[model samples]
Target: MRPTRSVDYRTLAHLRLPPAVSDFIDGGSGDEITLHENTAALRRLRLRPNVLSGTGVPDTSTTVLGTPLATPIAVAPVAYHTLAHPDGETATVRAAGDAGALTVISTFSGQSMEEAARAATGPLWFQLYRFRDRDVTRTLVRRARRAGYAALVLTVDTPVLGRRHRDLRNSFALPPDVRPGNFDADHHTGLRHASPGHSAIARHTTEALEPALGWADVAWLRRITDLPIVLKGVLAPADARRAASEGIDAVIVSNHGGRQLDTTAATIDLLPDVAEAAGGHCEVLFDGGVRDGTDALKALALGARAVMIGRPALWALAAGGGEAVHHLLTLLTEELSDAMALCGRPTLADLDATLLAPATPVCRHTTTARREAP
Candidate 1:
């Protein structure tokens, strides 16, 4: 049956995916505090609606890093799409293009970057992780550039894989039929493992990823690729400022979907600071806990050029491959349009901080009179 809502796909995915694969996609690091907090934080924000602002149908179209989008939403780079469906990243790209959104292909994608690019009709960006081999990293960057990807999204926060308890408990591994298409035979060998109570991907990451990666590598990447560079996983205002100073094309205010740091501030909570620090020097994109259009609207109001949907895309893919993914994007776009119309925002430009109202927190302390005892 076709799912009517974006979250309905999540339910369908949970039923379709194997336990380990589902856990890998759903679980977060440590106690999963930040994972839940991400959405909770977004829900806590109140939208201040303007009733009489006479506005027609709202225009949802916008651009990020100069790439036009039908809506201010993009599909985030989530590895191993083959785990969700056989077509993998190719299907994802197609769906994103059909929905008039961008797709950021992951470095650990199950489909080759070239294939993903070929499938994409709209803008595409390649998300990068610094590998231990600089030569291999260079090869990937060159491949992305040759494939005509619009930008290189450098994920900076993952020095090492986070301790996801669910993955560990499930002993997560790519099913035999699925493999990382980008890795050559020699590189792929290290990614295979059969250790119980451990994540094979985590072990692969530890051995293959560069833990000592720094800003200098960003310079190295710029010299190697002509494509625009975007720094993802930036949660700090200072880092956003530095990215602007460094002339980076954009910065994604993300916390790896709360998959890395367990108790870190929600991406939306950090968006304002990062946006303020960037100060229009570079574009600010956001990801993490964007489950609906209102959440995307809130992120934009706080100051984000666009937002990315991660798990929801995966859920949609698992539910019914490309078609479901397109449905999910459409739902988000429609919801955002509704939110904009109701908020009196005729266009993306009209969405501002003024549309937001501070959420009231629950107070724990209570006052009582002591005179009754006397």
Candidate 2:
């Protein structure tokens, strides 16, 4: 057998991650209907080129959550970076900082939030998983604020952890050895098997996990922290509208990377209506299946102020550690620039629905109907 050459870190990360972690991050709930749809939605978008529009070296600079980002691409918060590499979130933060992109540190990181924040050279946003424990949630928010985080990303989609079978089949545990560094001491508990009737996964996720979180919580959060709050996991237009009305600084159109709800609407498929409902009321960002620069461009064209990449970053980390993650980000930046020049989009603002032709109609009427109902 030929030994694997030291190819690009991108390729390496893609290969290094264990099947269990891959399935956990990549797999969707029952049937993975939405997981497949996220990628399928991307395939259905056709880019239209505006030739001779004087690209003159396209600029990828754009602002997200009122902070100027070198490019509109941010790394999505994926918990337990240590699963990818020993260095964990620290390595990921370093890579993101070097690439001038933002890294949203997961509340469940292997490295403490402070350490990750200190490691990050670029802007940082702390992703909060509001547990049933309001105190824990509040402590995290306060810590993030003190750490100089630019924003607070409340992942509203996961009131309860979604069905992910890989972890179940793998009988995955946090590997008693690998601890979530940021978790308060009291949060730790003994392991329990995931059973069909009892949603072991949901039960395992932060116990005081607030399922009752609503726009009212957003209002409460605003009073507690001055950091701009961006609500992630919003796929419906009405929810998007409600978020805007509740004074959210931004709305991330995501389906929890297709890990939460199985038959949920694809984030890209739902972007148009959500954006329309948003109507410049808030900055609209996107996540879920954004694998490349072109994918980022396509999302921008559909009205996303920025895009977040999930699995790819972890794959890169797993394959080649921090170096691989850095290389992948560089590749994506270069690719986005190239795509922008080719599409004649001088800036993110230049990308719009005009640059894309619907390759196939993404059926979103059911979600839309739900939004319109009394």
Candidate 3:
């Protein structure tokens, strides 16, 4: 059945995906403390609504890094879309384009960069993971540039893949038919084998990704491609400031969806500090635990240029396909508009820190009045 809400899509995806695959998408590292915290922090923010203010037909449109968006939301890069649907990234990009939203395609995408670019009618950004093979990394960046990707998103958090317990127990590996499309067949052959008690992905990542990757590499990437660079997986205010000083185009304040470095602060909780450090130097995008438009609104109010939806896109894709993904985005956009209208914000610019307040506790006990007062 077609689902009308993001949570419904998640339920459908869970029902359809293999247990191991479901765990891989839904479970985070360690005891999943940070994963849960990401959403919990957002929920703790209370909206200070204005009732009498005449705010009608709120404008949800905005632009990020010169790219116009129908709403302040983008689809975060997720690997192996074929794990969700046959059409994979192609379907996902097409849907995003139709909705006038940006799509960040992952380096581990199940489809080739050229194919995904061809499928997109809107702006596209390529997310990169620095590999041990410098030549291979250069090739990927050049291909993305040639494919017309508007930006390069370098994910910095995973020097090594995080210890995801689910993948370890499930012995997760791409199905025999699935492989990373961006690389030569020989490059990803090791990714196809999963031993009984280990993750083939972890093994492949160990062999391919460079653990010693550093800021120097960011300069190397800049030299390789002219595309604007965005650093993802940054949580510290200092790192955001550093990114801006280094002339990076943007920074995504993320904790890798709490999949890496467990027990870290939530993305939304870290947003305000990171945004302040960025201080208009670069665009600040956010991801982690954004399930609805209200969540997006809170992020925007806290100083995020936009918000990215990760697992929800996969759920919607798995539940239906491109069409369902489009529906999911529309739902969030509508919710953002509703939140803006109800809060007396008639445009994205009108959403600021003033719209937010701390969620306070309610007291149940009341004091008795003295008879002398009468």
Estimated TM-score per prediction? 0.95, 0.90, 0.95
Model 3 TM-score, all chains together = 0.95
**Per-residue lDDT of candidate 2, residues 223-332 (tens digit):** 88988999999888899999888888899999987788889987888998999999898989999877677778888899899899887777777877787777778788
Model 1 spans > 4 angstroms off: 359-374
Candidate 3 residues 1-374, lDDT tens each?
76766778888988888887788788788878888778777766678887877999999889988988887889999999988888899999999888878999999998999999988978899999999988888989989989999999999998998888889999998887778989886867778788888899888988889999899999899888888999999899989988998999999999988889899998988999999999999999999989888899999999998899999999999999999988998899989999999999999898898888645332222231101000
C-alpha lDDT of candidate 1 relative to the true structure: 0.87
Lowest summed lDDT across 10 adjacent residues in model 1 is found at: 365-374
RMSD in angstroms between candidate 3 and the native structure over all alpha carbons: 7.0
What is candidate 2's CA lDDT for residue 161? 76
- Candidate 3's C-alpha lDDT? 0.87
> lDDT per residue, candidate 1, 157-234, as tens digits?
999988989888878877887788887756576556748998888998888899998989988988887789999999
